[model samples]
Target: MESFNAGDVAEKIMAAIQKEYKELKTLNVMVLGKTGVGKSTLINNMFSEKLADTGIGKPVTDKIRKIEKPDFPLAIYDTPGLELGGQNVVNALLADVTEEIKKGISSGDIGKMIHCIWYCISTPSHRFEQTEVDFLKAFLNQTSLINVPVIVVLTQSYSKADARSLTAEIEKENLPIVKVVPVLAEDYEIDEEYVAKAFGLDTLSEIINNVIPEAVKKTFIAVQCANLEIKKRRAQAIVATAAITAAATGAIPIPFSDAALLVPEQITMIGSITAVFGIRLEKGTIYAILSATIGTAGTTILGRTVVSNLLKLIPVAGSVAGGIISGATAAALTAALGEAYITILARVVKGEMNVKDISTAKGKKEIARIFKDLLKIKRDNNGTAIESEIETSADNTNSFEIND
Candidate 1:
C-alpha cells in the first residue's frame, strides 16, 4: 500500500521523456530544388524548428550540404547548387548526389542513410525543365537498388488549377516516383486583397509517413509538425497499448492503495506520446497534469479519497469492491488520463494554448474537465476508449512537371 506520490512520479516521467528523446533515431531527408523554389520555406514549416536557418550545416559534397541541429534527430541534405543549367551540370550534380547516396547506403546504419528524397519544383515556373527530368531518370536508374522513396513536391501551388495541371503532366512521365505532392507550405498573399491559405503540407506529411522506413517512422512522427492528425494517430496508438497494459496489471484486482503499480505503464505511455508531439514537458507541466487528472498532491492517485472521486466520475467502476480495483476500471482511468493529455498537447500544437500556461489554474481546471469527460466514456472489450473519430476531407492534390 505505497502512497502514489505526484512529485516522484513527475520525476520518473521526466526521465522517461529524456529516454524517449534519446532513443529516437535521426530521420534523414534530402531536399533537392533550385534556389527560390521555396525549399527554405518548406523546411521551416515542415518541422518544429526553423531548421533551415538554425541547423549547423557543412558541405557533404560540393553541391550537397548536410544540415542538422544539436540533439535534434533529423538531417536535411540540401542541394544549393542545383539548377537545370545544362546536361553537363545535371550529370555533375548527379554524380555528386549518387555518390553521397552510396556513401549513406554503405554506412550500414539506417539512421545514417537517406530515408527519403524530396524534389521540389516551383509551380510559378510553370514548366519543368528537361535537364531536371533527365537528372531524375538517371538518378533513379543508378539508385534503383537502394530503394529510397523520392517525392516530387510542387511548391507555391496557391493555384489549385495549376497544381492539377502540373500533376497530370508529372504523372504522364511514368517515373517510378512515390507521389508528386503539391504543397503551399504557408499562406501566400495572392495580392493585397487576398491571401491563399496554406494547404497540402498535411498531405505531404501523410505521404512521407506512409513511405519512410518503419524504424524511422517514430522519428518522423516526432520531428514533423506539418500534420497534427499524424501525431494524434500515433499518440492514440500508444495510449491504446498502454491502456491494455494497465488492464493486464490490474487483472488480479489490486488494492486501491497500491495502484501506483500502474505508474510505470502510464509513465511510458506519457513519455512516448510526448515524443510523438515533440513537445518537451517541464516538471511543473507534468505535475499539473497529474494533479488535475489523477489526483492532488495531498492524496495521490490511488488514495481512498482520490479513488472514490474517480469512481464518481467513472460510474462503471461500481464493480470495485472492498477497496480493490478491477482491470476494466484501471484501463478506463488510464485511457481517460491519456486522452486528456493529448487534448492539452493538441491545443498547444494549434497555438491555442501556451505551454508555460499549462501550470496555471485555468489550464488545470480545463485539464480536469477533459479528464472527467473522458472518464465517463465507455470502453471496448480491449480496454480502449470508445470514442468517435472526427474526419475531415482534404484534396491530396499531387502535381509533377514533365519538361521535355
Candidate 2:
C-alpha cells in the first residue's frame, strides 16, 4: 500500500480551516446612545480587537455613523447621542437610523443587516429624562417591526443599587427591549482615593450571545473576549471533529511510511484550537510547536514500527486487523495532541503562562512532557499498549523533523 502523504492531508485541513474562517459573515451591531456613554470603551474591552482605535465613524446619514474596521468580521453602527431639547433633531436622527436599517434589510442579506441594537444609558446620570424614555420607546417600536432585538445597556454603573434602580425604572415603563444590562465596561477613577471597578461585561456578553442568531454565533464567539467558557466549548467541538477525521484517515491501513498523514490533522486541530484563544500564530510557529511536542519524524516511524510489530505478533495478515490498530492509534494520538494544546492555551489565556514562552526551549520541553503524559494515558485507557509504546519511542528519540 502507498504511504499516506502527510503534506497533502495538512494542506487540505488548512484549506478547510481558511475557507470556514472566510465564510463566517461579519456581525453588525448598532450602538445607540448619547456621547460618553462608554460605547467605544465597551466595544474595545469586550472584543479582541481595539475597535475604537481603528473605528472611524463614516456618516451613513446626517446623524447615523457606521464604524467598521477594514476586513474585520464585526461592524458597529453608532448613532448620534440624543439631544434632549430639540424635537426635530431627535426625529431626524431616528428617521436616519430607520432608513439605514431598511436599506440593510432590502439588501437581502441578514448578515449585512444589523444583528442587534444596544441602547446605552449612563448610570451616573441617575435617572432617564422623559425625552430619553420617549426616544427609546419610539426606536424600539420601529426596530421591533423588523424583528431586531434591542438591549438596554446601563453603562458606567458605579454600584448595584444604582443599576437596580435604573433597571426598575426602565421596567416600570416596560419598553420593548430584549433585556436591561448594567455594565461598567472599564475601570474608572473616582478620585485619588477611590475607583469604580469594572463589572457586568460577562453578563452583557452572554445576553448578546443568546440574542444573536445561531448562524453568526461562531463569529461572535471568535471576536468576543469576555467569555472564555464559550471559546473553550467551541474549541472542544473542533478537536472532536479533528479526532474523527484522523480516525477515518487511519482506517485506510496504509504502511508505516504513510503514517505521516496523521500529522496534518493534528496540526490543523492545533491551529483551530489556537484561534479559539484569539491567538494568531505563523505557519512556521505552528509546525515548530508540533515538532517540539510530538517529535514529527519520530512519531511516524515509531507508530509504523509499533503497529507493524503488533500485526506480526497477531499472526494476522488481514487488512481489517491492521485498520483497527491504525485507526485506534490515530484517534488516540490526535486526541492527546489536541487536549495537550488546549491545556496549554487555557493556561496562556488565563495568564498562567507567557505566550512568548511557547517558543522557548523550556516552554517546548514542558509542552513535550504534557503531550507525552496525555498520549500515554489515552493509550493506557484504551488498552492500546502498541500505541503507548510508539509514543514512548517518539519521546525517547526526541528528534524533530520539518518536512518539505
Candidate 3:
C-alpha cells in the first residue's frame, strides 16, 4: 500500500478552494468626487492597496473607469470629480453614468451593476460652495431616479467640529443621500507640530457593508481593509462551518485509510479564511505547510498510528475503536486548525510576523504547536473521552441490531 502524501492532498484541496473562490460574483462600487478630494487615496487606504498605482484599470466610459485587482472579487468604478461650475461637463458625466448603469441592469448582471456610490468632499474646505451643493443636489436627484444609493462622504476632516457641521448642513438640506459618513481615510502630517490621525474609516466601512446587498457581503468583507473585526467575524464563521462539517464527516464509519475524503472541506474552510484575510498562498507553499503540519504533529488528529494499531486487534474491537474517533474529535481538530491559522494570519497582517516565513520549517512548527494546544483545549472543554464515546456508540449500535 502506498503511503498517503499530505502535500498532494493539500494541493488538491487548495485547487478546489481557488476554483470556488473564482466563481463568486464580484462586488462593484462607484466613487465620485473632485480629483483632489483624495478618492484614490481613500480607496487605497480602505482596501489596503494603491489600486490606481497598479495601472490595470480600463476605461469603462469617457467619464468612468473600472479598477480591478487580479484574482480579487471587488471592482471600483471611478468617476472624475464633477466640475461644479461647468454645467455642460456635469451633464455629460451624468449622461455617461446613467447609460452605463442602465446597460448593466439591462444585461441582467446585477453583480456588474454599481451597488453603492460614495460622494466625497474634503473637510478642510470647511463648507460646501453653493455651486458644489447645487451640483450634489442635482446628482443625487438624478441618481435617485435610477434607484442607486448615494453616500455623502466628508473626507480629510482634521477636526470633529468641521465634520459635524458639514454633516449637519447636508442633513439639514434633506438631500436624497442614503448616509453621511465622515472619514479621515489616511493619517496626515501637518508639519513637525501636528499630525492628523486616521478615524471614521470603520464607520465608513460599516455604512458600505450595510448598504450593499447580502449576496456581495463576503466580497465586501474580504476586500475592505479598515475593519479587522469584520474579517475576524467572517473567519470565525468559517471556522464554525468547517467544525460542523468535520463533525458530520466523523459521524460516518470510514476507516482511517480513507480519511482523505475529509480533507476537501477543511481545505475549503482554510481557503475561505485566507481570502477573508487577503492572504494568497502559492501552490508549493501550501503543499509545504500541509506536509509540515502532518509531519510535525497531525498524527493525533489524523490517527495514522492509532488506526494501524487498532486494525491489528480483534475485528469487533478494532471497529469499535475506529468508531470512537467521532465527529466531536473532527470538529475539535478542525476548529483548532482554523483558529491557529487565523492567529498566524492576523499577526502577519499586523506586521508582527513575516509572511515569507509562513511556509518555512520553523513557522510550520509554531503553527503545529498552536494547533495542538488549541485542539487539546477544545477536547477538554467538550469533556468527552474519545474511547468512551466510541465504545458507547458502538455498543448501542450492536444492541439495536440484536433487538431488531
Q: What do the candidate models score in CA lDDT, each in turn?
A: 0.82, 0.70, 0.69
Residues 133-180, model 1: lDDT tens digits: 787888878666689899999999999888888888888999989999
| Model 3 stretches with alpha carbons more than 4 Å out | 250-255, 292-294, 297-323, 379-404
- Quality of model 2 by C-alpha lDDT: 0.70
TM-scores for all predictions: 0.93, 0.80, 0.83
Residue 301 accuracy (lDDT) in model 1: 57
Q: Can you tell me which runs of candidate 1 are displaced by over 4 Å?
A: 252-261, 387-404
How accurate locally is residue 106 in candidate 3, as Cα lDDT from 0 to 100?
A: 76
lDDT of 3 by residue, 56-92 (tens): 7789887798998887787888986565548788778
Q: By lDDT, is 1 or 3 better?
A: 1
Query: Which pairs clash in model 2?
Result: 4-258, 34-81
Ranking by TM-score: 1, 3, 2
True-structure RMSD for candidate 3: 8.7
Which candidate would rank higher by lDDT, 2 or 3?
Answer: 2
After superposing candidate 2, which stretches have Cα over 4 Å from the reference?
A: 1-17, 245-268, 297-329, 376-404
Candidate 2, residues 247-309, lDDT tens digits: the string is 666454434454533455665676567656666544444544554554442244325544443
Q: On lDDT, who's better, 1 or 2? A: 1
